[model samples]
Target chain A: AQSVTQLDSQVPVFEEAPVELRCNYSSSVSVYLFWYVQYPNQGLQLLLKYLSGSTLVKGINGFEAEFNKSQTSFHLRKPSVHISDTAEYFCAVSPQGINSGYSTLTFGKGTMLLVSP
Target chain B: DAGITQSPRHKVTETGTPVTLRCHQTENHRYMYWYRQDPGHGLRLIHYSYGVKDTDKGEVSDGYSVSRSKTEDFLLTLESATSSQTSVYFCAISGRGIEQYFGPGTRLTVT
Candidate 1:
């Protein structure tokens, strides 16, 4: 079974400063990686995904993650953040390939990024 | 924005009562899923449907039951509402790939 671990439960950053939310996963087989963001009282939206291509993946709102196979980590980072970037971020892994018929993603406990002015 | 909607956007029920949450999608996607979100835990799958009349359990399915009688509707039922079950419920739809779309959640409060 695939599982995810988000190192920090909450990360507070000043506006215009850089931020990084750490995520690590454990899966026996090859897997797909994804980052999702959720606003207060809103559903989760896909930020970015890593299927098989470039290890450095860029996403909406400038969220980018690097897939380190050896480290089993996909950490989300942003050079600068705004007050509007305050939200909870999640990292997930889909261990089974697409041919499995349906997508089942194992999600990590979200890391709440608190952006302050 | 996957053309998915969940009924009873907010519901309050008493213990020992039965409650069913409805998830309807217009995309006619072959896969529909029900997940519950609580503080700290991002989201845990309760159940998922592959097709009409076909369903499977997920990581957290002990207290829930599901049914998919048609292609566009998936229902999740709680036989007896419990305090621990109070959380936000989200419905998601997917095709045959790693991309999945989510719907606005439904908040359920059990008293």
Candidate 2:
């Protein structure tokens, strides 16, 4: 079984400052990683995903995440943040090579990014 | 934007009352799922459907039940609601890839 852990409960950053949100997962088999962002009273939006090939995955809203297989970590980073970026971020993982019909994603508790001016 | 919609976006009910939430999708995806979100717990899967009339329980499925009658509609039923069941419920549809598209969510309150 696979599980995810978002190390930080909340991260605060001023506008134009860089920010990083840490995530770790545990799985016996290979897995696919994803990042999703949720705004206030809204549903989750796909930020990015790492299926294979590259460790660094680019996402929407100028966000990116690096997957470190050795450490079982996928950390999201952004060089500059905006006040609109204040929202909750979730990290999820799915067992690799699984069919979409039976695949399920295990999600982390989430990290709230607070971007202020 | 996978053309998913959740009905009764906000609801309030008394304890022990039965409630049902509806999810409709236009994408005609094969997989659908129901999840509840609370503070400190990002999202916990309650149930999922791989096809019409085919459903399975998830990590937190004790107090919830789900049904998918048609390709586009998935229904979640809470028989005898409790205060602990109050939460924001989200419905999702899986794409050809491993990614899932989410609905706007329904905020349920049990009084």
Candidate 3:
């Protein structure tokens, strides 16, 4: 019964500009959050994850996301983006503890980030 | 890719024909999963295996079957291919957490 919602279907940004991709989840219990990126004709790669401890988690490629427990949001942000950063990003969530024994991840629809010069 | 590979990277079959996709891994991970990606749907899990011969159905498992006979290989089969099944399929593996490494993906089409 867990679900993820990415508000933006597409985000267009110029090079060197800051960008944020919004993600929200609905889960009754504690959950693990993750962000993944997929370039053209390639598989998804992990950008970052929020397991515990830190509220602001930094990830690969100069990306960071903050896990706001009260708002049920984990939005990804970057100070600046490059043309190579153009890719489809996904937000995923999995419940904590024995309930997630299989470790199944529930993913949002995805947000396509189009970075241009 | 985490040493994961999917065979028949691009396949096209008829509606009534049977199709099977193979996923091979070299990392010897304990968990393997099969997911399908469609435009606007992101990725939906079809099946997963915790160990050899120990498989479980995922959220979108209808009309699909999976088999994991060995730790290194997982196979997904469609009894009858349909247009709705025309999408990219990805294989993922995880050792201990929810962090999964994905394969290059196989593009399947039913004409």
Candidate models: Cα lDDT each: 0.92, 0.95, 0.94
User: What's the candidate order when arranged by decreasing TM-score?
Assistant: 2, 3, 1
Is candidate 1 or 2 superior in TM-score? 2
Instruction: Report the number of the highest-TM-score candidate.
Output: 2
Could you tell me which 10 consecutive residues in candidate 3 chain A have the lowest summed lDDT?
A95-104
Classify candidate 2 by CAPRI docking class: medium
> Any runs in candidate 1 off by more than 4 Å, and if so which?
A98-101
Off by over 4 Å in 2: none
Q: Candidate 3: which pairs clash?
A: none
Query: Which lDDT tens digits does candidate 3 get at residues B2-110?
Result: 8999998999999989999999999888899999999999999999999999999998999999999999999999999899999999999988666889999999989
Q: Report the lDDT of model 1 for residue B78.
A: 98
- Runs in model 3 with CA error above 4 Å? A99-102
Worst 10 residues of 2 chain B by lDDT: B93-102
Question: When superposed on Cα atoms, how far off is each prediction in RMSD?
Answer: 1.1, 0.8, 1.2
DockQ for all models, in order? 0.72, 0.72, 0.62
